[model samples]
Target: METKKLLKAAAGAMIVAFAISACQTKKTATGQNADPAHNSMNSVDWAGTYQGTLPCADCPGIRYTITLKDDDTYVLKTRYLEKGDSVFTESGTFAWDENGGKITLADRGEKFQVGENKLFHLDMEGNRITGSLAEHYVLTKMTDQITDRYWKLIEVGGQAVADGSTQKEPYIQLNSEGNRVEATGGCNGMGGTYELKEPNRISFSQLIGTLMACENMEVENGLKRALESADSYHVQGDTLQLFRARMAPLAKFVAKGK
Candidate 1:
């Protein structure tokens, strides 16, 4: 009877030891105590500013600035010169890839590819995105103040200038208050009265201005003709770029400083 009891006790101890060893082995293999949110691909953080120059022959080279946000949204800013005048700002929204490797822009309601790195291509998935790593470009995430200061271009349609020589000298000048804009000829500056129709559009009706001659009356005449031909104006940054449907390139101007 004593031998049997000792044998039973030894068997129980062996079983318990084997069970503990098996649990430790399982824990070692699975890392059960490790962090639940940890990921292996959090190496690249693409939440910042990326800037570059875009090539254009007819106008000054376009300056590009893109800002990314922590929530994965983005904005793009472009500056370019046109017909001896310069436009300083043009902007739109942006999107990013899962691993933070690529970015895209909402170019006229479509998601367009926009990262400097070619490793990952910016592609859209319905409303989501997928892409690879970027190189040679900086991605700066957006902040409150940054968003507040963002400049957007207000697109006004194009117009046709009158047929007289005086009508060809259309020039615009900002009022001392900056609230009103007056132009000379094209026809008359008084005919052009500015109306802030919508948040993104500036309308000019009955545009009129005084008739004057400058050093280069011919060039001034051409400028006036261009301005008179403008059916709409877009104000971006500290500059405005004018567009005409039939014209190949756009016109640009700097905003009057306060």
Candidate 2:
């Protein structure tokens, strides 16, 4: 009877030991199997809005905003600054490369690279993007609530267009309300009304302004032409580009504030 009891105790101890060994082995295997995906997610948390500024050879610094979607997709919007003008915004998309620990952005046929800790830098990470950077964060995943904002222009192409052609000098200004428009003809301030159209379009009409005589008239001539010839408008980044139904290239403006 004693021998049988001892044999039963030994068997129970062996079973418990085997169970412990199996569990340890499973844990080790799991850790080893976690490759790029685990490392990528561990590095950058790309769930919010990202904004930054990068240098461009043709312009000042270009600012950008990137929104990550819940579905693992992303939208990238950027701005290009011109000399003495508002910035221009260019938008596109991107994807996460888990194993590579970097986000692969769509460059519209432009080449981009991704690597661990080698991503472009960014400014603040929040609802409002502010600051400058040379690199963007490498995205790992995206959510659905990413696309929510639309950009508006306070000034027409790089310069403002006035209503009259008689001023001495041509100059532009966005009224204080930012809703009204006006400009300096060579001699006086011209005024006008404008509207935002559908699907990234804008128009100006019911235009009227004051006439005056001044020393300079070149700007007055151009301002008068811009107002009469203006047909359509589009806003990108801080830069605004105007169009004239196959007549001319129109005017371009940057955002009012820096």
Give the number of the best model, judged by lDDT.
2
Candidate 1 per-residue lDDT, tens place, 107-172, comes to 644343333321222234423232332332222332211112212212222323333434334445
Candidate 1 accuracy as lDDT? 0.44
lDDT of 2 by residue, 29-112 (tens): 654434554565554554445555556678776665555545655556555755543434444566544343335546643222
Candidate 1: worst-modelled 10 consecutive residues by lDDT: 144-153
lDDT of each: 0.44, 0.49
**Lowest summed lDDT window (length 10), candidate 2:** 142-151
* Candidate 2 residue 186 C-alpha distance from true site, Å: 4.6
